[model samples]
Target: MNTLLIFIGCGLVTYFSRASFILFGDRVKLPETVQRSLAYVAPATFAAIMVPAVLGDDGLANLVPPSPQVGAIVIAGFAIAKTRNMAVALGAGMISLWLLQWVGL
Candidate 1:
């Protein structure tokens, strides 16, 4: 019962916080520069979350060893750069990762 109540409380909080944006965004009238900067927020947030997970505490030094994950990321990055398609990038990354792992890298 306590866990159920806690979950309900958390859900309400999350919903209200997100709903507030939709409900009040137009009234807020943020500056043009701020609005423009908001476009980068998602990518910046994604990088912030992913970079630490990918690089770990050692950061770039972790890449010194041949890692399947790093190799897959590089392959995916190249695919995205060349093809500019997310599906292609994902396919390239997954396939490369599988191949690398199969080769016991």
Candidate 2:
């Protein structure tokens, strides 16, 4: 009924929005200006998420676990940069955070 129709409508919209890209990937080209802007998307997106987390009241650092979170994230970033292994980086980072918090450091 109403619920089912709502689901169907949402699904159709989602499908079209996604499919529209594939359906016309090569048919349309973005201008050079737009292309350059698109290149900033990843850094912008990362900052959008990380900036708020790292900075809090008075723009002070809000380390993970409120103390060693910064250290953990640094370790994680380093691991990711050096090894390029996501799971290892995340696992090490999270473990470091927990260990620091657990030890009451």
Candidate 3:
């Protein structure tokens, strides 16, 4: 019962917070530079999350020997560069990782 109530409270908070933007967006005018900078937010956020996970605690040291993960990232990068398709890049990365792991790196 307590958990359910807590979840409901949290959900309502989140909903209201997000809805506030839509409710008041017209009145809140941001600067052109701020709006332009917002475009980089997603990619920056993605890199922030992925960099730590990919590099792990050892950081750049993990790239010394070129692990399966690094190989997959390289393949995925190439796929995206060549095809310009996110799905293809994802598939290429996943497949390369699986293959590398299966072959014992």
lDDT minimum window of 10 residues, candidate 1: 50-59
Cand. 1 Cα-lDDT: 0.88
Best model per TM-score: 1
In the range 10-96, model 3's lDDT, one tens digit per residue, is 999999998986888899998999999989999999889877877777778769787788889889989999999999999999999
Q: What TM-scores do the predictions have?
A: 0.80, 0.67, 0.78
The Cα local distance difference test for each model comes to 0.88, 0.81, 0.89
Ranking by TM-score: 1, 3, 2
Clashing pairs in 2: 64-69
How many backbone clashes are present in model 2?
1
Clashing pairs in 3: none
Question: Per-residue lDDT for 1-105 in model 1, tens only?
Answer: 699999999999999999986987877888899989999999999889876776767778768785777888889989999999999999999999899989988
User: Per-residue lDDT tens digits of candidate 2, residues 2-104?
Assistant: 9999999999999999898688778888789998998898989997998667565635545433567766778889999999999999898999989877887
Instruction: Kindly report which residue pairs in candidate 1 clash with one another.
Output: none
Measured with C-alpha atoms, the lDDT of residue 105 in candidate 1 is 80
> How far does residue 32 in candidate 1 sit from its true spot (Å)?
2.5
